[model samples]
Target: MTATSRSLSFALKSATVRSSSGHFLRELLANEHLPQDELQARQDHAARAIAEQAMQESPFYRRLYGERGIDPRILDDPRRWAELPILDRATVKAHSGEFATPEAVGRGVRTALTGGSTGEPLRTLHDARVPSLALAWRMYSWWGIQPYDDLARIGRWSFGRMDAVKNTIAWWPTRQLSLDAAVISEETMTEFHRAVTRVRPRLLEGYVGALLELADFLERRGLRIPGPTAVATTAAPLTAPVRARLEDAFEAPVHDEYRGSEFGWMAGECDRQDGLHIFSDVRRIEVVDADGRPAPPGEEGDLVITDLRNRVFPMLRYRNGDRGILRERSCPCGRSLPLMEPPQGRTIDVLHLPSGASLAHRLTALFSAHPESVRLFQIHQQADASLTIRVVPGPGERSRRHVEDAVEDLRTRIRHEVPVRIEYVESLPYTGGKTKYILSDLPAVVPQAPTPPPDTPSVRA
Candidate 1:
């Protein structure tokens, strides 16, 4: 074999060694070849097992099932699984402790605190060497990344002992490098760019917004770092414009990953770049309509998920708070795993009306007509039921009329006099160095609000 071929062969072997028991890796390889009906049967069996265990072990779930009069066996029936109550982030946060079973805790599962884009901290527990990590490794493998290959990640640093230890160990075998996304300036970007140059990672992963900002800075400074084989973005939506820009700046293909802190690596883009393939062996994903019915293929709905492997804290039919469409057909890549549209954003960001109604993905529609005038926008809802429309206007008075027109259009679409006010600025302020599209300063928002939207919306030219 050629020297390059020999190096790849060695790396694959190292990856196999690093995947703990390699149980998940082996299962993932097998499941990919399984027919759709067989795959669904496996997921159904796993789901029923998780539900039964949750009712038996978890205090929170046991009490919830008892109160709702839901038999744990309902999950055993494919049709009845939809009848079980849905759990959201607030419910999980409130009863997080009860979600952890004595057996799981005694067996020493790892707990992770994920604040996400909402800035609300959520703590969850899983096995120390969770199957989700193996799923992630498999996804990376699709992008030609082995577990021991170099990966440069840009995100906030975790100071926990476990995080530190994992980082230290991952670096040795994989050369994992991390750059802080929380701090960004000319000096910091220059340093981060330099680090990427030295590491020369095979894969780059992190928040799309942060990378886009860094890419912009690098392009302006005429500093061209060699592109990695692939760039994967999580924690935020990988909008088309941002994806194109990142690909241009880094000279690499950008792929989107759909996952959350509650569950790691639910689905990911394949080499086809068509839609994300569900990690069906580990998690069962569903797109449900308002009445909690399964949405037809190619129709958008709320994303509900069930964790098949997280026995400690069963996340069955858990509302992911994101909206996406379920694709009707199989992927051209020939992977038996199902497909779904990349999430638009969180469900909380959907404008809620008191008339037993809510609107999804409508926030961007208000400014669509005023593309040239608006540079960026943020919608902030106040406690007193007033709306603050924050806008970063583009240069020149020619665009001012369009901005005003857009605000008027928003008021009309809202169909309510909620006291809309427009605030113009050079740029919208970011919390923890990240910009949010929709923010609520209302005191009763968190733990009460249903759908909180993500960071600031990008301007259309």
Candidate 2:
């Protein structure tokens, strides 16, 4: 066997114990070389298989189709597949367990919880692990990441004893080191620099917001660390400016990836970096108009995805609550996967702490400290590592003790010496009809001076 196949086989075997199935990497590699027409045919075949399996094993999907007087067998028609009803977040939230495959009831399926835009949390169950890991591996390989490579991530992670132990065993093969994204203060950045210096990982990956903050912090201090071959950003919209800044700061190419807590690794930037290539072989991705019909190419619409492999909780034509555009043209790299713009919306800011914890950590602190009277709120992190909570309260006067107790709760959760202040506001700002929830005041871009020639002496102005 070839070296690539041998390594992939070992990785697949290692992953099988934790996953419900294996043999994904081999199929994934084979699909990579398929032409666009052949890939679409395979995708349709997989989509039909998902529909049939859902009808047979999932009571929720069975009833959903039955109630509409529609036969699941009709979805077998490739052209009629688009005629199926579009599933929204509310449907999933209202009928959570109904979506899970009955066959996986006793199996150890994975659960994912994500905070929705309306402040309600939606939970999803994943029956398949192959698609996620395979898609991620494909994208990372574009940036020279391989199985068993060291990948350092900067994000919110708790260091409790049991959690740490679980992380150690789970991440041993990947050799992932976690840095706190909740706090990116001077001290936190210093420790991060130290960790990177020591580990010298080949890949740096994390939320775009935190990575941008780190890049800014490092650039401002005139500090640079080497050995990272590539940097990857996720969990937020990666604009051209942000990508440029990150590339400059890391001194490496920055690859932006698009995915969510519900569905993992939806699309990612190829080496071309022009736009994200959607994994159409494993997923049926569509940009649909408000009427749920396929939107015209280059037009922005709601991102609807149907994962072919996730049988536990079938996410067929599920609206992902994000907006993006589908490219009309193919990628220059000649990959058959369809191209997409980076998803826009649902971004949070990082709250720096003395000890590394981030993303979810700061979010937990904020939600725990949420006042009963507050209807809407936004959290902002100041340059001094202090946090300000701006709230649009309900009708009533909130007592000073209530505010103090909330502040104390936040302090207790953060477990750090940072000022937490609450400000009542009439209304909070919105970006594109959605509340930003979290905002950062730190500078993400720094101006660089031109380099002086080595042969020419610097002139005093």
| Clashing residue pairs in candidate 1 (N, C-alpha, C atoms within 3 angstroms) | 348-451, 348-452, 349-451, 436-455, 436-456, 437-455, 437-456
Model 2 worst lDDT run, 10 consecutive residues: 364-373
Q: Return the TM-score for each candidate structure.
A: 0.71, 0.79
RMSD per prediction, one decimal? 14.4, 6.4
Candidate maximizing TM-score = 2
Model 2 Cα displacement at 256 (Å)?
0.7
What stretches of model 1 exceed 4 Å from their correct place? 1-21, 116-119, 157-166, 346-461
lDDT, candidate 1, at 206: 76
lDDT tens per residue, model 2, 47-126:
88898888777888889887887676775678888778898766786677688876565544776655444333466877
Clashing residue pairs, candidate 2? Answer: 156-358, 182-351, 182-358, 183-352, 183-353
> Which stretches in model 2 have alpha-carbon errors above 4 Å?
1-22, 128-131, 157-159, 169-174, 346-348, 351-409, 415-436, 439-461
Q: Which candidate is the best by lDDT?
A: 2
